[model samples]
Target: MTEPAADSRTELSSLLHDLHLISSEKPLPPPPLPPITELLARLKEKLIGASSDSETSSLIGHVERLFQTADPDWLFSLTSVNEEGRQEELQAAYRSLVCALIGCADLPLCGDECSSLTPAAYQSVPIRAVPVCSALRALLGALGNWEETGLLWSVAPPVCVFAVTHFQDQVWTNPPSRAAARSLQEALLRAGGWRDSTHLLVGDGRQREEGEEGGKSRGILGGVLDVLQPQLTKDSWQRCEAVKLVFAWTLLQLARPSLSPHLPRLLPPPLLFNDHYRPENCMLGARCLHHIILNTPAADLRQFNRAEVVYEALFKHLYSTETTVIQLVLSCLLDLLLVLEKPPSSLDPSSGRRKPCRHDDLLRLVLIHMEAENKVALRRVYASVLPLLVDRMGVAVCRHLRRVERVVLGYLEVKDPPEETNRLKVLEVLQRMTRAAWPRMQRRRLHMLLRRLLQLMDDVSSDSQLDDLIRDKLMSQTTLCIKLLHDCSPGNAQTLLLQVDSSCCSPEVLGCLETVTMSTER
Candidate 1:
């Protein structure tokens, strides 16, 4: 407790505080996108202007040294220590190194330089001219090339995957060098993502005989799978985000058909399949799969059971708080359904063409999303979920129908359709569900859902989008309801028409009414 000792302790504490020794889960605003052009220029200058060949070799050696020396965890820790502004400075430096190694701005390798150089000399030799076009292709193609086991470049997939999935807007804006980027990306994939289960690697022999497909994978991808399995399987929520982000990027890259054959590890269920039920997780899963399915070729979707898994997970998350995770899940699912109608490559073989899992969960999730307090969130959820729901219906479907009834019944019934574009989605889903499952649906349940839709039509004001959607829904439902009514009791046609009249009173509702009337008469 001497004064000198106390002063020393205080100074040390201050230094520690300044260094950000403490960890924080509170999300920091994401680092700004790397300044691709500036970083590329610096890298080009560094490579092209070395005083001697020895110095140039030293620079390349420095690049390699970074991989060996830099501790990713240590760098992550520093992020918390620095102020937001200072953190940006650190990130800028980090990005410069990444761009330089990845070859963001290509150097010209012409004459004897590209052709005459030996392997070691070639690696050290600097390209003087810019190769932006080649660099861009390399950057995009990098994902496919990422490998883990080969040389130093193989590890680039995980890093690139991390960058592209999380900071895609920035990474794509101004990549350094296409050829180098591709080489790095492929190296990363080969190094990390390809390896998964012994089954995936060794199962190839058996899988070939069974004709079950998409099972073999290798390289950095394999390493990534090995690394992620423990983190995902455990309840490591924080670690899971890292795994998921990388997974998303990998999915984005492997979406192409040509690349599809190489990605057997991802096709099977990921290790964290159960965790995706959380809203954020679901969102990540949905968005990643959405990108892949849309971008990749259409194959037997039965193999990649992403849709079913997403449906199951989002079903659980639909009721979560209004966070980016929930929104992402909803938006991703919507996009997935809209853009890619089939399952992903990882589907269970037994499920057949129809998704093995029932879609009741998705229906329920959409219902919950519809109830959100935020209009924007709610609308986004509706835009995506509604269409899918319209495509499928069940006993639970009626429950959502009833909920909609309570909300829509209070508004001024509009004649123009209900234009809450999201609701139109609801209507579409309802229509699809009814059309497909009508024969199997219970008589009482079908009647109740139709009544609810009618009530919703009565609640919203006319001519608005909400009203417009309701009207269209009414027209569609009215026809189906009439058909159901006639199926139940042919003698009660007039009575059903009267009920329809009572429910739909406005001019637009009347047009739907007329349709119902015609149907009844027929």
Candidate 2:
């Protein structure tokens, strides 16, 4: 045998002998094993030099046995001969073991710049020699036991990065490896609290440039982002679902202020996904964007027209036929609009006339769509979102009232079965619009709206398909709509209702009006 092979055999035999002694001793003072750092270093060197599958398997078997037999407390316990020296030694040993196991598992740790072997190169290693799933199982076992020693936190950041990078990746094709990775992730998170855990995952954002301290302290998130950013191109992100999912998972764990600092690194992936041709990707991207909009401060999103860029991306989705995509886009646009321009103040009617903004543009588009929309599901979605848009528009809803009137009239006339979800939402919009733009709810408009609402009550009362609960709800909402119209344009709605020909309306419809008037009196 070559000299190096002889040395490797000698080292392996010594490690096995130590493990046997440690396992056999039932007494307190077991024979001392080699320092952990030296022991794991030797093991890593042997694994790297392993020439055949049998050698690799034998080495891995020894590792699994060591983890199973060694007592964690004894392994990490400080020696009295050099307590301070031993503490540092133990920490280094812990870091070494983690790094060794992660390498043996063939998981990517750093990108090409930081590592001697890039991910692509790591992929070239023989699977039998590396045994990725087995390494991950052994690593998880070590981490699970080490967690009780409290030494796990010292080495958590790298393990966290590995977990996240490996999390749901296509490279981890083995089901057992995937499960092992997931368990390791939960173990790390439990060892580190969520905020602190995510903090480590995102890193401090102060990554040093190359050649500076060898770029050793680049934040975990920054490093991952660097690797991921290049993969977020138009053609690339579609194939990078795992990358998108990881970014979404991390972004959701953070909120405003905390999330603001990382926006530059965090924003690109979702935008690419948002612009994808697939509906599922589009929806996922929109959800990520929505979380960003809700959690980020208005001022941060407004910087450098960031809000406008997001608005344009989401605005195009308004034309999407996918209900889920449209829903997410509408929600994202609503919150984003607040960043672009403040909501029109109801306290000042003049605010409505102050130059049209994107809110008007969006509402105009929605109204045009609503005017022609034929799908019941879409009508319900539009109806449900309309009230929120009007609330955001405040008195500015008056600008779209001409179209709003058309939408309300058309939507109310349609029969939304099982539950009048669309009609109910339209009534809510009408009530809010009346309160915001009471002055516009008048003259012929008031007469037309009141007549349609009375007709609706009659229509609802006569429809046998509606249950008692739905009928009552429809009558009550119709009553509230008329009551708001009357409240907004005092005396006019009541006068119009009173002047209605008795033969034109049913007694139930008329009773609903009576109920509104009575409630108004009270």
Candidate 3:
């Protein structure tokens, strides 16, 4: 842990020790809850005395012995007391007390001499404060301001994870406790609320981040992947089936760009096989991959030596039983295709295929989801994927362009007014074809496709009133065809242009097309 965090935890721990001492030692109150002013004053006095006190260790020992014995509710009640709406003081005090409780969880009593230590005895009565520690963090996390917050400061904060992991060790070593598991479940569930901010993954070296003030922002949980690995089921996939939800949630949190560098070690081996070998683990890994692709920059992805782990896993799961998994796979593949200039060799067939795999493989996988039931999302994937295939393989993908063209344009024919997303995708296919495939195609086929684009430009509704958005898209696409044809052969382009007629070719578009549709090849 960083020094500041250590210092914060130590101070909080000491303060809680005082609260324990004062409440238990002082003879007072019918129900003597110290008022806020007196409480703060007494705390200040102890903190000042603690600076020079030679008996500090003895005091800490007393608190540690009575850790579970004292009422956990004392600080909870005092910190939550309403003091005329002066919430800042309450929140400050609360933050310290909670951190200290988390510190208590961090305490180690593994020595053989410690007979009273909970783990040393298999059936010691449950520590009420121990299990509920996590729930307390969760409850307070839920009540805090998360809107403008980045991540769960409690989760992402420095020492808190160390404390929690220490608790996890005790839970693992002992006979199963329902109280601890239930508490952890609530904590993990609500713990997810803190990531309200959009985070960027820094893939360059992925080790640690440099702060603006030249400090490091590494969290306690960042380098602790080994501690989490067994729980991840990476080594033995079957053991943690009962705790998969908690495991999945924890792994996902750790997969954020900040924590993602450890993924190669943390994820299952031979990533492609995880889907069948362990479905829960595979899905969590896949979801984390989806988040990484969406949030991280493409240039930095190379730093992840095992990125193929993600693509390969997602690819195998393209036929997954779960719809959400397939959709996430498709989304991740789409991002990969769009962001990277070339397909990574992860898609290469081990049996020595004649050509490197391109977007076609991803497209084919996506095509499986095109049944009427899934057309909404997969259609968008299809639309986006087609252009990428054309751009990547050039004439190689167009060996049979007609079938592909039909599949894309088919979306436009479905409704009286076309879906804007699909129509734009059709235009994208046309745009890619004209840009990449035009030069190598047999002339007869090239001209045929060009004529089809002209027809789309002229496919005006019989009624005079047209949606402005559709008209603009239609005319812009026609301009692209005109540009492509002009670059191909101006006289031939003019012939197709004349067929557009004045009505669909509004003066603005016609003039724009006229200006650009000249033979520049000369």
Candidate 4:
């Protein structure tokens, strides 16, 4: 190869020199929240007024770095997806980025950039809006223009979902974040998030409804829906179960009159349902249904495209042979139980009565898991899941005490290694199960259940291969059960209390009792 002359300044040669300069900059500081507003204000100044393309471009790089700094999660995720450590960091950073982007868009910089940049840049018009308010939508409508950049267009739901979720965790108190979220939804909806299998269009890719005026969309939305509808079939973000679920979630947030028509195609279990018995399909469908159950308003459920089909899909997945799928299903079911919002009177004939809810169906579904053969079931999920059920639904779930007793008794049979861990998990669930009375159960049955609980406490075996930590956990769980019952039940708690003395209580249990008594006295 011949050496190039230095004076020519070939585009490729100049790019190489620029890369070296960028590589020499100081490492970005750890992204704390305090500096962001100021950082953005400076970024806004450079973006709006700078005539230098190079300066504008450098500031754009700062924007990306800001996202990386604000959310190490984006870096960790981009670097090592399977690593669990950065999930919290990613969530925090993501929330900050969402808020910051919205903040920047509201600045004069955004309007200036909008004008200076070619219309080609804002081609995917609506999804790229400032606040997605009626004003912005109308701005696009009046200008007859939109974004050329589909940059975040396709994956907007998952991004919107994560932002809204973190905002919810923050208690939805940030008005800018909330406005930004609504703006994003309008943008995405304009991008066509609510289509399903039945939405048809002419091959030239225009809506068949000819007379509706510019309703003859180049059908950009129809294409976006097509991409999202069987999203996973194509792989990457489109195929991700989380992305699929959040898409449904974003739609639920918008249940507007124009938007509700799009729900059937984008949601509805049957449209997305394939050979759901496959673990990947089952997990994807279960996850999507989970968010659907969560995001759909209680008032809109019945009207939201065969929601019964969705619930039935959930019911089937609860019995999934795959424990991972079942665990995921359990989480969705638990959410449904918690958020089982009833329809308002005008929306239902029940007129504020406790209309038939999927929660009742969920309770029956949980009992089926309990009723499954103990040796066949995954005790790990069962143990953790049942307690959450009883805790959330309270006495209504306690009605199934016989099922609980049967499950506990079935687990207590074997001291073998195969059964040891299962025993520990069941003991934890059982302790939580006994925190309140089963008003419907016979006192004899309660006695039997309580007796089993005591027997579990007393059956310590040093000969077992169980390590000290495992044994301690078992003992601690057993002690807490007694404490919970002691606190929550009346006569039953009193009856159980008589069974424990210095002899029955392990040192940990004794210590726990002392703490309780001391606190009570104070």
CA lDDT of each prediction against the hidden true structure: 0.43, 0.69, 0.47, 0.47
The candidate with the higher TM-score, 3 or 4, is 3
Each candidate structure's TM-score, on Cα atoms with residue i matched to residue i, is 0.42, 0.72, 0.49, 0.46
Residue-level lDDT of model 3, residues 1-522, one tens digit each, is 111234333444444446663443333222334443344444434433454324433333333333223233433333444466544555454445334434333334334311234444433323433443444444434433331222233333322333334334343333344445444534433444322211211223234434322112223344234334554443443433223343344445543355445444545532422454445455655665665665555555545544554566567776665655565566666676555435432333555433535466765544434433244655665565556555655645554465555564465554334446766766776677666656654456556666665555555433256687777766676666557756666666656656666765556655655656443433
lDDT of 1 by residue, 1-522 (tens): 112234333432332232233233312332222222333345446755667655655555543432333232332234343565654454445444444543433322324311322244333212411232233233333323222212223233334543333232322222333344344434433433434322222323222334332324222345445544454433442432234555555455443443455445554333244344444444555565555545544443334664545455544555666566666655555554533343321244575433423344455555555554445545554555555554443333443555543333222122322244544454555455555444444555555555655565455425344444445555565456545544544454445456665453776556655666676577
Best by lDDT: 2
Name the candidate that leads on TM-score. Answer: 2
Backbone clashes in model 2, listed as residue pairs: none
Which of candidates 2 and 3 reaches a greater lDDT?
2
Question: Weakest 10 consecutive residues, lDDT, candidate 3?
Answer: 194-203
* lDDT tens digits, residue span 1-522, model 2: 112234343444456464443354344332344556566667667767778757767777777655545554444544432554666666666666656655565533333221233345445333432344355445445555444334555566556645665656465434554565666667555443333545655434454565553112333455446545675665555443345776677778777556788898787778888887778788888999999999889888889888889988889988878888998888888888888886754343665345677888888999898898898778878888999988888877878888999899888888888898999999999989998899877678988898899889889988888989998999989899988888876678778877878787778887878877888788
Stretches of candidate 1 above 4 Å error? 1-168, 171-248, 255-286, 289-316, 327-358, 361-376, 379-418, 429-493, 499-511
RMSD of 3: 15.0
Distance from true location, Cα of 108 in model 1, Å: 30
Task: Report clashes for each candidate as comma-separated counts.
Answer: 90, 0, 0, 15
> Global lDDT for candidate 1?
0.43
Candidate 2 yields a Cα-based lDDT of 0.69
Q: Pick out the ten consecutive residues of candidate 4 with the lowest summed lDDT.
A: 106-115
